[model samples]
Target: MRSVWPLVLPVCSALLSANLSAQPTETTPATSAPEMPTEAMNSCLQASIPSAAATMTVAELRQGCQLLYEQQLQSAGESELQEQQVSSEDSTGDKGERLLKRRMTLEALNRANRFMLTPHKINYFFPASYTRTPNESPYRDNDNESLSDLSKAEADFQLSIKILLREDIFGDNGHLYLGYTNHSLWQLYSDADSAPFRETNHQPELILSFTNDWEFLGFRNVLNDVILNHQSNGQGGLLSRSWNRVMLNSVFERGNFAFALNPWYRLPESAQEYPGDPDGDDNPDITDYMGKFEFNAAYQRKDDIYSVMLRNALDGDNRGALELGWSFPISSNLRGQLKYFKGYGHSLIDYNVDLEVFALGIVFTDLF
Candidate 1:
């Protein structure tokens, strides 16, 4: 029965082959017919697979109808990796730009601080003339002996340190100044035989000042200043003096000319002594209120270095003084100035100490 079954299977296979060969011998040409249009093909495929139809393009529908196939392929490939790399580089570049801007701002602030903290150098000259009678006598004697008739010259070289405090510490446009001065002078001349004859005068002074620019009467720019000064000499002939002064100054400007008026008052610290009798032995006390008014006119040039000041003082004795000064830079750290002053007064000439006096001096300054 097994042998018969095997022979039956072979006959069946032959029969099937014979039937297929006899049924379809029809021959078709290579260009049998034009292929269906892409839209028609896609419509036919979409009808067969309705879910794919909604998203299908004609070419993709004809080729393959798979969900997320292209997207998955792209994600696994270099295109997606390249996009991510580019996004990362852009983020890093943005961060770098922010950091660069921050660094530049810091650098600019540091440079400005360097300029603001820089130090300054200053120099100044202080020359004062004092005249008093040789004796307590108010009138000139027949002997023609008076300390006021005697001429003396004293000058000081001062180096100042300037610092900017609050502009509003005292008031708007106000400034504070602190200064120390070392001074030495030659007595020039003294009459030991005469009463109250002076040997020499020398001393040091410490000064503090506050100054302001204020408007007066709504039209005038007035300079209001206050000064506290302390002067001392170890010598017994002259006593220590401490006083404060308040001054009001006004300036008028016209073309290249400037005029200034200053009125000031000095408060006494203590009683001051003067020479009384001959042999330089007797001394008398002189204490009183002192006030002074000064008028000045100046011609200024563009250089601001060369100018002449015609100054007159109105006090107990009317006096006129002329001052000529010149300023120039000597070096980066040093500066120089030359000044001259001449004055005459009845009190200064007849009753007081000095008559006609001249002074010459130079100064050097440095900044750090």
Candidate 2:
């Protein structure tokens, strides 16, 4: 790592030299606010080291400081900032006004009522794909029509979005969020059919989160979220698939790593009335594949971030899913993401179907 001491010493010496040889300014009225450091260098120094000029006069900055004073002030400011892991407050305007403005700005930025989590940012269009369409469809059995009669094309696309409903309704620590995610397998290359959505799944969930910062078990406690989730394909009859669940999630962090554990209980559904019924609780054995709990772990390595998700039934029958993801910087506010999935529960329709999928897309936010 480059040492700032070399660069800082010379610069500080020059500034001290200049300050010791500068002239004083005329005194102003007692009620008038003093002029602040406004030059690029002065502003930067003040921002990085607020105490460096806490009691310095304009004349001192311009012509009165010696090497010893500058060194002491710089060391003190740097030590405090490093210990707190926070930047020094900006020094501008009158003391009271500046402090008030800073407080207001910080509150606005962190208000719990305001939108905290991002809603819809990850959406991508792909020109190639593969998939096994559902053998039975609700629309076909109910209406005596083929809902997915078309053949799978060589190219397809998918779209999804999420929304935040409420944040910190009770206080600064509690949050309520509503999210929706949709996935579609489109036959984009089928000119004869005009690109119909071969398979579409809709997922909506309501989640309540409570956050606290502390250290436990060598890890930092991040947040806890309780979720009521519903997922289904907007289909009916033999092809219908849907489920509801109540889940508990806990998140933790340690240095460059973030980890989460999610456990859920499936809400019971009314059974179909008759033996031939095709509707109620479509996939009763879904838990056999989807599992009751999942774990997510993410780590940052330099500019790239990697994440892994794992789920297991924990019963004698071995079944679950595993997903691996990597995200790298693509721009200032955007990141390119690549994901690979193996096993079941990739989607509601594929809850019981073993499948493998690889996806490349852009993510607007980092898990960090």
Candidate 3:
């Protein structure tokens, strides 16, 4: 592997650029060239053709791969000219429909910069959130304020968005963006507390996504992301919880079904000098419960979407989380949502605590 990258980097560069639109070339008469063959090798050669690299040098693979990419590009463009088709994933059918819409159509090839802010994740709000167990350990720890009375029902919401910063920074495909997401839990029913915010987690991230149209088993793997993420619940001493991660995400879709793989390596933090110390890791064992990998899947039927998400630490303790959800159309942009969660990682403050929650809410959008 060490020797492989250097040897294939130049060849791979030529395949999609495989960042991977082909370089522009002069067109000749149809008789001038023999069309190169690409037998539905859907993605760029770099990702799907490592085995082939063993036998060829960059010079040998460049010409053939580029020609195949060109043909695929030509055919895809032609297909788009036929009767327009709509994707179930973009149920709202709004303009600038992103991610999935981009995946299901050739519009993704139009990588020209029409920079705009877009939703990063599913934005949702739950008005009747009921949790059986409220982790009060953090509030009881030294240096933290005490909270004697708590409510079993409250409100929860999350807002997430991203903006394109640049396109094709490296080659023809890498698009960069800045993103932020905030999740808040409110004691809406606690009149004595004046509807205080019980917990709030803020996430700010830098994202680099490599766009592609790779196909396998009727699924198109459309998005690849490399992210630098920082998440924290702003607080002092024992209530403080924060961590950083380098995460990789790969997203795939086929018809109304979509799936994603999310995995991350937590950046190391210094050990706290003492409990409640502010200048060190707020939650060093975060990975044990939040897990290093997560799998998410969703399927849509008409106006309804069924989804499930799983996270696992893959260690002896078997810590992590599971969530199941159903979202149905309530309006053009708003959808009714019902969700249940068990285990950990519901929020930064609850990352180590096991709890069960059932919530009814409205989501601004669906995951697909």
Candidate 4:
């Protein structure tokens, strides 16, 4: 599956779009509008106008025609709304159709290779990330006496992206995708230590995506994803941390709010005969802290977004994590992020250690 079209798809997402309201005009009154193209008018224009050596841009031409259409509609004292606008909600309160269709269009573009790569997760960097608990036992276990001091403050960032492998690979349902995500922690403030990267986790996944419309108690199920996932820290011996899992991701959306539930099962590996054994399970008790499932919710209020994540180990130890985040628009193309985390599994190297973290940064891509 990884070799299929350079490997693309990864997981789940459903996009949101706002309704358009007409701007106040000098002569005409308007209420609301949706982006719609006039097929007949476009066909007529193409037949009449000279195609070769075109001087006018498509936007200019479209704007002129749209103005004419609006004037005609206003003359009849009626408002025209698009019948196919995904933003339109039903009176029964069964929403998510809008978001569902929008996602379908995005996936269609991916299949067409027009937008092959898409954001799989929130991409952000915090140069001044502070963690109250820094795991130093690994360094101590390494016996590298020269590196004893581990800073509590560091820089952290994550990059996650996916590409479409094939749309309708199952003839109608499954859309295959390959995704890669990278997480890294850097000791940028430790200038005395030359600012080396402390740990980096690499994840590459295969996803089978399906569009769904199931609803229960006013909530709409918009997406379902079956994923094969592998993550590793690219280390050896006692420092090695790696695991593989089969995961299920189900996403739901209602109005400007979205939610996701992800559960995974770890694949078992052989136990080690002794410490630092080469061919044995690394971090065999990782699940005891990282948990078996995660839940995420995001709510968008105009240009600002608020999100929260929760996880529980579902065992006697009852270990897990909680992360809260806020993203506000800084400019037309920029957004600022503030995040707080209290829990375990901030990084693979510190899976067993609990920490409280606060970070402020800028976001390149965000959760929708």
CA RMSD per model (angstroms): 43.1, 17.4, 13.4, 8.6
Best by TM-score: 4
Model 4 TM-score on a 0 to 1 scale: 0.76
Best by lDDT: 4
lDDT of model 2, residue 15: 10
- In order, candidate lDDTs are 0.31, 0.51, 0.63, 0.67
Per-residue lDDT tens digits of candidate 3, residues 219-269? 777677887878888777777888888888887767556677888888787
Ranking by TM-score: 4, 3, 2, 1
List where candidate 1 sits over 4 angstroms from the true fold: 1-156, 161-167, 170-173, 180-183, 186-223, 229-235, 238-244, 249-260, 269-291, 295-299, 302-304, 308-316, 328-336, 344-351, 355-368
lDDT value, residue 236 of candidate 3? 73
Per-residue lDDT of 295 in model 3: 83
lDDT per residue (tens digit) for residues 1-368 in model 2: 00010000000000100101111122321222122234643643443333222333444333222222333343444311100111223111122222222222222222332333333213444454444553334334455343445444333233433333555566555656565556676656665556666567666666675665677886666567777767677666556677777877776666546677788888877687653355467778989999988888766554566878898999998899998878776654456677777888766666887877776665543443
Q: Which regions of candidate 2 are displaced past 4 Å?
A: 1-117, 120-172, 189-192, 274-279
Give the total clashing residue pairs for model 2: 4
Clashing pairs in 2: 19-63, 19-64, 20-63, 138-236
Over the stretch 1-368, how does candidate 4's per-residue lDDT look in tens digits? 01111111222344422211122222333235543356955863464244211333465445434444444454454674322222223432223344345444433423534334677766778888997767788878997443457788989998877777766666567777788888999988874578878899888888888878888776788788888888888788878887778888888777656788888888777888887676788888889998999888876554577888888889988899999989886643357889999999888888889989999987876663
Task: Give me the displacement of residue 129 in model 1, in angstroms.
Answer: 14
